[model samples]
Target: MTLDPRLNAFRPDLADRRLEGQVEARHFVDGRPERVTVSSAALRREPRPDAAQETEALFGEDVLVFETTEEGWSWVQLQADSYVGWIASAALGPRGDGPTHLIAVPRTLLFPGPDIKLPPLMGLPMGALVTVTGEAEDRNARYGLTTPTGAVVTQHLAPFGGAADNFVTVAEQFLGVPYLWGGKTTLGIDCSGLVQVALAMAGIAAPRDTDMQERALGTRLAGIEPLRRGDLVFWKGHVGIMLDGQILLHANAHHMMTAREPLSEAIARTAARGSAVTSIRRLG
Candidate 1:
């Protein structure tokens, strides 16, 4: 069987030790584990800063480092979904204790202390993980102490294993977020990114790109009839969520933002662009 380079940690010169006998490489070694330390870091196709960004590694996500170059790039595979790419070495740190909670809202401020009045150190996006060590109450508001420093609003975090009741409802929160290629956060997001992030909040694991998602997610539907809420509609390189039988929601380049519209309208627009819906899928 052929292994996908994007999903497997392998290259012409080096490969993960785990794939020792499965692939050809000049050398194989065990990869070291690391954690993303920045709020987010771009995973690029090449080591250069100008290379195409394939995805973003959110804060506290785990990655297995296979190689680190003097130029400060590290070839790593994301533990969340196993996507492989080169990320900045500086963005990673020792993998400490496992995360205890995930940011549940679109975005939240990471304050230096429990008080909201203090300037925030940074903003953590939804799905960013953190190890909550304790809690504090100030001015009747609650905050969660995260690791070595910083505090985040307690209400914005959900326990690691907790899931939202409906993924569609979670997707609805980013109705107007700007469309961004290779983006995964609410500040900017793309079609698959929106789907992936929302489904994650609902405890669903999904791949990172449209084609990968089309092949890996849900059961493909045949007739496209009686479309209900939470159905996924796909085009050659695009995807949208069925808000119901009639409406579609997606972060689209056409709108340059997450938008909702009639499914029929989206169908017509896509058809006018010389493409047709490739598949419709329903999650069981």
Candidate 2:
């Protein structure tokens, strides 16, 4: 029997070398390496630790990979922000298809057109990951979101200049939500997902995780005050959205998911924890 050439690419040995780079989730679109899938695994140096965070450099800097396997495990790498560590194979996926946008609001949706019939999810907020599948036609841009899920989630956002505008609305909706670890839904979300989902709604695509988002956005503001409507506020290991000049909204684990506070307040909150604000980026 002959195997389809497309199926041939699914083989693990097809990956010729052990690798190192920021591991990103997969997006289901036709682009080269679409943003989707969670990086659930890692290939480590040695002596794997029982705890994930205590493992050191295991989570953030985006360096994770594994050889293909029909079974549930694979080798891993931990190289987020130059800190390297290893984690389990179960955490990662063969296809990098997670989500391009993180949900900022308690609930949001994607649709085949700008209409509200095909909503999914059981009530969520904060860090829900949404992959864009399609867009509204000129006649229907005002009513719904057409997504890859083949379900129309909501129809409130007007399909305006690309998808960036959609992000702004999504960001606005999540005025408050709690943050959580390894979380990407409204139930709990981190700073970056707040920015990610907002941008995604505007028809622009980005990563679910913050570090990956920072790299993709490019260029940081010299000061937070100069940021635009869709700008992003980033801190060491955290991120958020810049609203107006004085405020930003996000689902902070410490603050609890979905809350709009002064950017200074957020900075102070992180500072209280001894984590200083790293930088803020203008994604728009």
Candidate 3:
């Protein structure tokens, strides 16, 4: 008998006997592009705009290589915690603008009025898109931006709208738009960007990222027990307004971007995704 090769080890066993065959690495993983090794990996609790995970180390059995073919399938070879999945190439790429300017390590500066470096935007890359909370003249730095991560970095930041009642109404105007990543305008917007700009228009300063936005609004709530028009409805990495007792309006990536989904259905989806009921901050 010939010795088994990596390509032959993957062959399915015929009857009870094993016949080795090598399986392409990407075949088992979901949403993989050209074949590539797992340069690094992480576990995400949820597959969403705001995915959070405690992170775990990689193991040889838990890894997969990307395929060289087109129209490839993804999703397999998951880690032990079952938090890892094959994400599409699009989502895997650098977020917010191109990668050239993402600083990864920005110069240290004081923020929110203090000479400190602990909170510096040193982690962000240049051209990384971030929501500006406001800027100020620090005793030590040129500028600082209150980042979507909610960190007050440096003193200089681009202008960002604040959260207030009026901004909620302004966001409503964007109903029925399409969802586009890295978009911050009415032309097209993702769940978080839509909320950010809409709130900006109304002068409601909300965070640029979904996780930060959730923290920026409302009291902790459960389900849709107390719903009303203008109440902020939180979903998996998305936010919407309670147009009435039964409806929510905001840009969504699941389907039609700017559309309305009933509170019950929306809530059910959140449960199905296994996320918690974060809150429902009223805007109007």
Candidate 4:
């Protein structure tokens, strides 16, 4: 039977007849639609602070609120990635409007006011979707965008649309960003996060994790085919994009940062560690 793509078995889908391994058909317990209010909210494995963080919900993203606990955590499934996890209840609010602009740059600061001299309200990572309320001129006559959080320079945002032509360039921008498990922001990002964000800016939709990405994105290359720019090479739990035929760019724990290296070197080093390249895909 074909299962719902979003059904990770944590949430009830009666038609699929599964919920965390139970085969009984059931209905949602207390599902409600909510919008993320914070810049980024952690989606944890359990409804507790010490639980492993599984993913994140960016500001303005909508989620299905399934259940809430007395400990102040709520089970939610992100609308974008359909990834389910527990998040702080305080980070969400009643459903709201969608986003108007996509954070195009690697990182942009949200200022408490229109002026840049003031302290920033928070920082938004690349690929964040934000709604613009109004526009005003900064001291230098540059356009400033007023959002729910505050203001950001107009240049930092782009109208949401098809992928850009420079995915490699976009990936290179996060060269020094630290590697974090389940992170999708410039503050700390995983290999999949780096690929997803870079491709997102270029107008392609990407799944949130390496395994899903390997299964869903791009066309598989033949065993003897030559690699080209934008090719995706994947191992068991890791992914890297080809900057060219010979160079691979990825966010890796080895360097503890995003870095580019020779593809041959990567394949050899990874093989030594017992994880060989499982597949290579090319996306249009």
Best by TM-score: 1
C-alpha lDDT of candidate 3 relative to the true structure: 0.44
Question: Which candidate would rank higher by TM-score, 1 or 2?
Answer: 1
Model 3, span 213-276: residue lDDT tens = 6776666556547777667767656677778878887777667577877878877877887865
The full ranking of all candidates by lDDT, starting with the best, is 1, 4, 2, 3
Position 157, candidate 1: lDDT? 95
Q: What lDDT score belongs to each candidate, Candidate 1 first?
A: 0.94, 0.47, 0.44, 0.80
* Whole-structure CA lDDT of model 1: 0.94
Model 2, which residues run further than 4 Å from truth? 1-164
lDDT tens digits, residue span 151-224, model 2: 33334322223344356677666565556554444444456656655665565666545666777785777873
Q: Superposing every Cα of model 4 onto the true structure, what RMSD results?
A: 3.0
Tens digits of per-residue lDDT for model 1 on 12-57?
Answer: 8999999999999999989899999988899999999999988999
Listed in order, each prediction's TM-score against the native is 0.97, 0.50, 0.40, 0.90
lDDT for 277 in candidate 3 is 53
Report model 4's TM-score to 2 decimal places: 0.90
lDDT of 4: 0.80
Candidate number of the best lDDT: 1
